[model samples]
Target: MTVTHALEGDVLRRQDPELADLLLGERERQASTLQLIAAENFTSPAVLAALGSPLANKYAEGYPGARHHGGCEIADVAERLAVERAKALFGAEHANVQAHSGSSAVLAAYAALLRPGDTVLALGLPYGGHLTHGSPANFSGRWFDFVGYGVDAESGLIDHDQVRTLARTRRPKAIVCGSIAYPRHIDYAFFREVADEVGAYLIADAAHPIGLVAGGAAPSPVPYADVVCATTHKVLRGPRGGMILCGAELAERVDRAVFPFTQGGAQMHTIAAKAVAFGEAATEAFAVYTHQVVANARALAAALAAEGLVVTTGGTDTHLITADPAPLGVDGRTARGRLAAAGLVMDCCALPHADLRGLRLGTAAVTTQGMREAEMIRIAAFIGQALRDEASAPRVREQVRDLAGAFPP
Candidate 1:
């Protein structure tokens, strides 16, 4: 039997019957929905197998060669392989694969570099930044004094001038760059220059673009920033996990921050899955996949714009596109719900300068499922119809079902 078939068989045999039913249901749901979540993707069968492997039974509380628990030789090898693969893939001097999620990785980075009440400069939340960058409700905001910069109102793109002004005035201990919704390519070199001028460490949160970066579809911050953090699941198509990569000078500090300070006992299973993902990412197929992701996004953006929707930044240079749905006589929330009913899954986005009328669409999930420009065209047509009339939704839903049937998840 094939790997996927074997995995399904194993799940059927070992898991509780109720749980097995739930798993089957979820698989059916994925098979039927057009998942457009920018921050999500489907992992390879190898990566999934590693995540569900017996390695989950082990407990390695510390870094390799210095574990607090015994019977950790295999765990150590798994983690070491993960770290080495990450370092090679990203060309970083060091890698920490212990973070449970992207937010955890950010916390570890903060814990390693800053004390309580340090000033941090980050992108404003509504301007495409993550809450962990400095939302008032999150630890980063609560513990550190955070000042934010926004994109230009006219161009809807990051203003280096504004960033320079903020850096000079705020003088934060760290300057963060990267976003979950911004469609254009990030100017990591510009961020580095600004951070240096203010004597602040540069932290690039490339969680959204990790896959593109790995496949050379986008610029990598590893060569320019003091530290970089990313989720393994997004573009990377790994298990739900996070990693931190940095220069060798800060390696020990980052490792300690992740272990004793932020979390205890590494998730060895997730780490092994990440190793599988890194190995897959190093292949020629992954590079082609990344290229197709960007191409698909651009195609979708063009199709939506042609249908009279307002695409943010005029276009996209990456796998995500944000569009204002007000011209289509609908708001973001309404569009999100309607799309779900139509089997096209996307997200509502809020811009710092505008109200929450924009919808965010990503190509990562669909591209991983082997979608191309023709599929994007059909998907865009369905979205356009769905937003045009609440009454026309049933027909649009049928179209979605047809397209989803053509491409099984």
Candidate 2:
């Protein structure tokens, strides 16, 4: 059976009906709605099986064949496969597949390259960047002095010249490039050039778009950046985990930072699932999926525009589209709520340089379900219709259910 087909089988219904009810309800929700959250995706049954395996019961605290504990032979095998697969999939000289989550991986990368109070240049959180980039609440911001640069006013894209100026003046120890809500292609090469001039390490956080990079559908930072961090899930459609890829020259420091500095004990089951995801991503089928993801996003952005919504950057170059309906005078939160009621799931994102909010929609999950341009247009109509009349949400929800049913995950 296909990996996805196996996930449809039964699990834990008899032992704990309450938990099973919650689990199954989520399955129903996923199968019934248009999931557009940018950083989410549906994992295959093989990944699910790995997550539920006995490998989770062990404690493997070090690298393969050199763990601090006993009975780690199988753990070593799983981790080795994950590590090798990540390296092969991304064309990196070294890979660390044991970070518990993407945020932890970011922290580890920082620890690997910088000491406390070291200065860094990164994109701002209020803009299209991550909290770990330089949010005052996050550890990276607390421990490091991070100068944040944002998108240009009219273009709604990163200002390379501004970044270059900051790198020259700040003289940061490291520079971070990547985002959580950006809707355009990142200029990683330019970031690298700035870093080189400043004698700084360049780190690219490709957590949201790594799948596209892995499938060769997006430009990769592997050859340009000093270190790269990514999540195994999201567009990659693996288990929820984190990974680090870097050159062999930086591998030893990266690995040591991940193990003894940032985290301890590998999640081997999740790593096994990551191995499956990497294998799947390296195939032709996965390449086709990422291509569809980008196409569908562009299509959806155009459709949303057709309905009078303002698409940021005039559209998207990746799988995500950020649209603001505030011009229609509707509160962004209320519009998002209406969309949710209409069986469309997405998040209200912060619009840079404005007091307004916007919706950050993605096509990764829908593309995974074999959706294309036509489906994107229909979904956009549902969004516009729902925003116009909340009373029409119930009817639109049924239409959403019908469309969702036609394409099972």
Candidate 3:
């Protein structure tokens, strides 16, 4: 969550000129280039204000009115508003906006549901899953025995039958779904049914598609998942924070886990921004943004495939598309570097059961800049040109600047 602070002029200059200059430089960088990072977005100005608000000074060490420390009257109000907005936005019985990040929210969910030795099933990180979903280095994997399910070798989509077979065999205490690089709509109901059959808790990590779910562009996991973990940023277009949504039955445990178990005092300022973002997500305007985001992603996937790039899963139903650049005669890592130098910003993910890596491109930021399918097609051409030869980058870079200027991020 690198914030290029567009602070209103001289206040920052008077305090720290160096930092203010750097912020402007970062803003210029974003303005001149394209952002294709799947798990990133440019939050609204209101969210930036909230992030830098005086609430950052608060030390309210507990939830709302139940704080261990005093002087929390406004903190309680702000948190309560965030909770209400989150629950209303997602149609959940309870919402906890206090987990410091997406990883912390996932940690809180695990703390609420599983003991140290409990078994959990999640998508493997190398194949587009998150680290918190049970990478060997993450706490979720170290503390608990974690088995993973992955997308099919040939088709780049999760196989539910494989998931069910693995669940039955492992008999995990929890079955986690939702992915960072996966480009299709998730079947939360199917995951729920499998969890029920295996008597496992279902934690849907909606970090990537929370906004889509809010706008009805994707299925909501709240109705089927026992717990939902998401970041307020990314496609949600909010602050750099995390939240958890669950039923009333698990509210207390989730809250306690987020508080003393996983993290200490809540970040009141970020929570306020989360509330603002949630309110925005509930609006018709944001719904349109989500729709455009999906449409642009699909268009980008098609355009890339048309250029002979191997777009994983054929195309996307959401804001992200994972493609292998091999057909362009470049490895994923080399392609990413060349594209960035050419003024397009994206990262690579490993392909399941393949030696080559997949590069994930997202449309959230560009959609925010008001670009649509036509722009996606153009950007894909730039990508194709750059990947064909680094010598083509100077021309592509100029094209990207003109395009980005037209949108003005």
Q: Write the per-residue lDDT of candidate 2 for residues 1-409, one digit (tens) a residue.
A: 2332333446555566687777667778888998999889888877888888899899899999899999998899888898898998998999999998999899999989999999989998888889899888889879999999989888799988899999999899999999999988888989989999999999999999899998878999999999999999989999998999999999999999999998888888889899999999999999988998999999999999999899988999999999899766676788889899999999998888888889998999999888999999999999988988889999999999999999998
For candidate 3, the clash count comes to 0
lDDT of 1 at 126: 83
List clashing residue pairs in candidate 2. none
True lDDT of residue 184, candidate 2? 88
Clashes of each: 0, 0, 0
TM-score of each: 0.97, 0.97, 0.97
Clashing pairs for model 1 are: none
Q: State the displacement of the C-alpha of residue 292, model 2, in Å, after optimal TM-score superposition.
A: 0.6
Sort all candidates by lDDT, best to worst: 3, 2, 1
Tens-digit lDDT track of model 1 for 1-409: 1133643776574867677767666777777778898988888778878987999999889989999999999999999999999999999999999999999999999998999999999989989989998998999889999898999888899988989998999899999998988999999999999888889999999999988999999999998889898999988899998999999999999999999999999999999999999999999999999999999999999999987789998989999999998888888998899888877888999955887758998999899878899989888888888888777777887777777777664
Which TM-score value belongs to model 3?
0.97
**Candidate 3 lDDT, tens digit per residue, 1-409?**
2344345467788899898888777888998999999888888888888888989999888888789888899989999999999999999999999988999999999999999989899888877889887787888778999888888888878988889999999999999998888999899989999999999999999999998998889989999999999999988999988999999999999998988987988889999999999999999999999999999999999999999899888999999999999988898999999999999999998887788787988999999999999999999999999999899889999999999999986
